[model samples]
Target: MKQQVRELFPTPLWVLDIPPSDAAPFNAKLRDEIEKIISPRPNVPSGSNWQTPHDLHTRPAFADFTKLVEISARSVAQFLNVERYPMMITGCWANINPPSAYHPTHNHPNNYLSGVYYVAVPEAGPDLIFQDPRPSLIMPWTGKLSPLTANASAEQAVPGRMIIFPSWLRHHVPSNEGTSERISISFNLMFRNFAETAASPRWKATAGQE
Candidate 1:
């Protein structure tokens, strides 16, 4: 006898890769701009990473990058069939994670989506781990890891690669075990005029025949 398995409630993760020829110079420019903003970087705990202000999208130096993000976000909105409401970047920042530095597991609140773009990665790249959001999972231990058995997924960081996912998805960056620091930019997007447009009820009431 044979039976079918029905998978439901899947999560969405969008990955976009830029051509190396174009990404090379583009990343170089971004690296320079990021370094300028974070020079004399603030001190942090041994395991913590340095982060730039969350307003990078508003800076003239990052206008091009911001535009790229907007274009990509529109594609995501279209895929999700929610293109009617406009999406805007609420926060954009760069992360400079030195050797042994890492980010804790967290989620972006009050936003519809979040993403990260890698500008620089060490010879031995770091991993971005996204945890399963279902708290009641009772999956049994398996000798090997597979999509059905894994509670978390690790995405390898590579320069010129951008990853986008739901803002509420919990994720974290592993420690930079490489000899050099790892550089990346992260951002969040939300529906514009959220309160006035997107938050209203979606149901339509029908009056009974009198």
Candidate 2:
């Protein structure tokens, strides 16, 4: 007898890893530029991380980063067969998570794609976790947890690594257990002129026809 299992409606998470040789200098440059913008970083309440202004994409200093984001976003759009429709960055910012600081669960709304690029991570390496969006996944488990059985998935943070996923996928960063701080940049992408281009009705009425 032959048996098979079919997986349906799988979520896509794209991981882009930069070679260490190039990433070393690239990440150093990014870290320096980030510090310049948020020098004397504003203090945040306990358990919260400091975030830079949400307009890095417009800053002249971040022009290279903005171009990188656009290229990456285009790659994603091409994968989904939507390359013809232009996608623009809606928001771009840096997140500085000091020791013990953490981010609560949240999702990017009104955006097509969202991603995080790690600039600096502690030696221990924390995780970026994505929560399962299906609301009815209340089932019991006993043995090891596989992809299908797990409710949440984790992507380890590494310098020069970029993880992209659907904008509406809920995710969060756990407390920074490592001694050093964790720095990353988060951004969102959405189709340009979405309402005018892609939001129109998919089906049009057939005049004078059944």
Which residue pairs in model 1 clash with each other? none
Candidate 1 at residue 61, lDDT? 99
Off by over 4 Å in 2: 1-4, 207-210
Tens digits of per-residue lDDT, candidate 1, 1-210, equal 899999898899999888989889999999999989988778887888988999999999999899989999999999999999999999999999999999999999999999999999998778899999878688888899877888999998889999999999999998888988899999999998989987787878779833
lDDT tens digits, residue span 10-118, model 2: 8999999989898899989999999998888677786779899999999988898888888888888889999988999999999999988999999999999999999
lDDT of 1 at 109: 99
TM-score of candidate 1 on Cα atoms, chains taken together: 0.93
What local lDDT does model 2 show for residue 100? 89
lDDT score, residue 176, model 1? Answer: 88
Best by lDDT: 1
Q: Which stretch of 10 consecutive residues in model 2 shows the poorest summed lDDT?
A: 136-145
